[model samples]
Target chain A: MGMHLRACFALAVALGAANSAIAETRLDTDALQLEVLAGSCANCHGTDGRMVGAVPALAGRSAEQLEARLLAFKHEENTGATIMDRIAKGYTDEELATLADYFSHLPATAELTP
Target chain B: MSQPWNRLSRRQLLKGLGGASALPLLGAMPSLAIGGQHAGHVVVVGGGFGGATAAKYLKRANPAIKVTLVEPAEVFYTCPFSNLFLGGLRDMRSIAHNYDELRQRYGVDVIHALAEDIDADAHKVRLSTGDTLRYDRLVLSPGVDMRWDALDGYDEAAAEKAPHAWKAGHQTTLLKQQLEAMEDGGTFIIVAPDNPYRCPPGPYERAGMVAHYFKEHKPNSKVLILDAKDNFSKQGLFTAGWQRLYGDRIEWVGLSNDGRVTRVDADNLEVETEFGTRHRADVLNVIPPQKAGWIADRAGVTDSSGWVPVKPDTFESQQVSDIYVVGDATVAAPMPKSGFCANAQAKVVAAAIASSLEQQPAPTAYWANTCYSLVGPNYGISVAGVYRVTDGAIAEVPGAGGVSPADAPDTVRALEAEYAVGWYNAICQDTWGTQV
Candidate 1:
């Protein structure tokens, strides 16, 4: 999965390789895992990570972008981060990757409950 | 459209249970949900953060699950942001929420009534309207009810003079009016209860907000907090913020300092502390000790400590089968009884129950919470934590989350304040689909 994500990220914002990578990851992860995992981000980021203002909405962001940013925050690579750094470090690299992939597919304004 | 409720048919009308089952929205149980169990009825009592969220998320997790929310209020005035209202930063309407979205958007049946009793043996709940609901699962987010007479000389009648304002809504408005009517230089006393109460950081945050109000309007008025605990949540940050922002306008008294208020003379605006020290106040806000809301007691879920003990992974009540409890009512220590924690716990229970109905293994269970307190309008401080079940209880992940650094600049504080509003908006949206 790391190699897959790295290769997908190397494609950089292009949906092709990243889509395939996440598509494979989705097969083994049950809906319960994905939905419950993503639900956590809803408190601050809005349901499906689609927070409308001040906080950037996570929906539709490329998986690479989301994963890369989450890693940077977790590792303290982003000095300007306030809360995300602390929150990101709580999850393993794999869990963060799952979250990034989870929010990457939703629309920017997905319904709170669908 | 306005709908009428009839006792002849009772499916659901309570918010307490939302903390137990609000996730999954899979269209239909994939024929694997325990062999013909097609997402049975979930009755939720209490429509606050935990219950409303559970109801909404249960539907989200499985659209086939019949979810009914029971809460007595048409509009739930949030206790979370009501402090800001106390500080004059917000209005009552901004903190008000309703069941409109939970009903129309999520297809949940929202019933406005007080849940009276729980027949655990029969899996039924008796409501104030003389109606009853039967459910395959029950979620109780019933919040807290004051332990009347726990504090000497403080009871329902006394609350009229020294308003607890702890439950929000009417008491919140009442306290604000008292603040407004007080003399500019008068002392406002806040009596904070002992530990294991709802919102560990709440009393301190209340002091901060009331001080803010006095700083702007009264200028010379002062706030004095009398606490039962020697230390409080975000103590250092709160103390530092108070000193830097309000500067002597607010003072806190700890247990060692004889800060425990033992008896109250509400009519005379007086209280006696431990060591027989009496103090007078122009405005008295007494937040008394509490227990799980009565329904939890009626449901036979609460322990002698007045809080419901729950399973680490699923928040299911230890005392009752098929009944789950979340929010202030549950013994979820390390996870403070904040709205954010309740909302987080609500989602996990929703997933756990949804998966159970689907005959699947439990879902990935981890929770994160961030609590932002504004010492002043542009002076915000926060504490965040990520938690997981460890040794059969919720424990904070080490090295992952903590209080904001002591050396943050005003610019960062301002940003955090904005983020506070964003958090409120997003979380409110997540729970009841209400925003301001």
Candidate 2:
């Protein structure tokens, strides 16, 4: 099973590179490594992954919604959000999945406004 | 319309450079090659306020760009609130920041290494460990380097005895130690540096904080500021606060009154004035003249004035086009060299780099700053401004911001203190990840 898993991982890498041709030209895997996100979203978003107004609650965002928003910026669909778009364009699909998983599992943070 | 954002006047650029070397306004274009991580790598030198801010923002703005921040030290002791430590309001630990949060929170590649050399032509940074890191865009925000010879008989060696505590950290602790070991009635004199220095109101605030200590613990002790310049930021308010809080207990001498320190005798604890007056103080906090960090000079970014010249709107180095110099290291005309200025400049640079990289329309760049100085415990004052890049230089937008109301009502000053701390936290969030 271990040997088979290793072979599958190797094949995944090979296939991932082969599939790069069909991927969007702007979709760079390295720049968008969501695993590198430390604590930047905590200010506007609650530490527990809840978000303030307009920031959108990251607590239960669907993986598709997350990927779509990120891809929207990478493809230049959203030009209004400069910083977010630029940051989103740097993530790889695998890392994006990790972020989507992490945020989706966290409980929603409560809003501070009275 | 295709011209780079805005061209600064030659006079303004010269004034910005302050007579260093003549550098091209805009030189070579960056390769625009695909960086290893999709976005180009941003190599940041220094881990203090400015460098840390830039590194954090670069990652936050676009995580695709691999950000490698290099600093020699393990921890950063901020100069902003160090004065409070000297006055016994806070401890050294309270003011220190470790990059652990920055690394864990921002996913920044933190290299605990001193930037010994730079191969700018090759776009490679050679770390002290003999490791080489390449960058597509380098952000040099190494803060200020002290010009020791500016004061006769005072060099790095003399600094051991008469500590500057200007850069904070160990020096701050050393100065605090000296203050602690001082005789109750000992004279504490702070020699203020010339213009183009960090935290213009810092020395005055230090004087106020130290005087606060003297008033409470050692009523006979006094503090004096021997300044090089005639005017200072928030001068009227600082002086008024000093008069009300520690009148006659603190003496502030400026250039107009011959406060310029000519020389110092470290062994004798004596400082000679321009007017031939000699002062012998038990404790001397000599904040010397400063220049852009040595890394800027080594990288050939600095001109004659020992500061890097850059296009204000883009924050790109004039000498080396692909590289941008921000923070206190850059000669940001009409902008005081402060942490707030550095944070604002980091945002502008981040946006411009993103725009340039994506071939998108550049956004109109603006900057904001709010410098707060604590006059005493819970007694604080502030000056806030919103800046706009005009004619290639950052100029304060008229009537956009103002200083904390003069001799501010107690309620206002107290609120300013609260806002000041909040502003620090908010700006820190803008610069670093909000983990802490």
- DockQ top scorer: 1
Name the lDDT of candidate 1.
0.82
Predicted model with the maximum TM-score? 1
TM-score of each: 0.88, 0.74
lDDT of 2 by residue, B1-436 (tens): 0011111122223323443323222211111223232456778888765678767656544444567899887767778788989999888776666788568766678999989888889999999999999988788887998997788999998988999999888788899889888889889999998798988889988999999989988888999889889998899889988888898899989999999998988888789988899999999988989999898988889999988898877788899867888888888867788887786676567656655554544445656566888898777887666566777677876644556667447766766666555555444444543322
Going through the candidates in order, what is the number of backbone clashes in each?
32, 11
Model 1, position B65: C-alpha lDDT score? 74
Cα lDDT tens digits, model 1, B107-213, are 78999999999999999999999999999999999999998878889999999889999998999999999999998999999999999898888898899999999
On lDDT, the leading prediction is 1
Assess each model's interface with DockQ, reporting 2 decimals per model. 0.34, 0.02
Tens-digit lDDT track for model 1 on A9-112?
33433533333332221111254556666676889887778778777789889989998999999986646887898888888898788678767866665454
